[model samples]
Target: MFKWEQLHQYGILIIVLEENNEAKWIIALGDDFYYDQNTMEPPVGDILLYEAALEDNEVIPLQYQKE
Candidate 1:
């Protein structure tokens, strides 16, 4: 779970990525921030896809991979 600081005043986040040999979960995060943009004009509320994982599952932190 994640939210933009500007769009979401709470600035709260909880991210846990995971993979399963038996049955894996494909977590993804989509954004239109366009890294090419200058730091002064960083994008906000661009992530369009936020999927959840199984409860208590082993996980990976696809920090940059999903973002």
Candidate 2:
């Protein structure tokens, strides 16, 4: 139930609430940006899901997660 605009900043952060009611946050950088944790970069128009949570006022990354 999230919108693209909601994740258009601060790179990309995905929040997933599990059945246990726990939230996880996944942090991702853009293809143009460099990341040691990621081997490959996500292409444009790609939506990457992550196990992460968002702060009250945080910007989501527009980049996708590698593989």
Top candidate on lDDT is 2
Instruction: Write model 1 residue lDDT over 1-67, tens digit each, in one string.
Output: 2323213221223323333322223333334334546565444443332334356554343433333
- Candidate 1: C-alpha RMSD after superposition: 11.7
What lDDT does the true structure give each of the candidates?
0.35, 0.44
Deviation (Å) of 19 in candidate 1: 7.9
List the candidate 1 regions with Cα displacement exceeding 4 Å. Answer: 1-16, 19-31, 52-67
lDDT of 2 by residue, 1-67 (tens): 4444333344253334333344444345434554455645434543444555454635454545445
User: Which pairs clash in model 2?
Assistant: 11-61, 12-61, 15-52, 24-51, 24-52, 24-53, 25-52, 25-53, 26-52
RMSD values for the candidates in order, in angstroms, are: 11.7, 10.6
Shift of residue 28 alpha carbon in model 2, Å: 11
* Candidate topping TM-score: 1
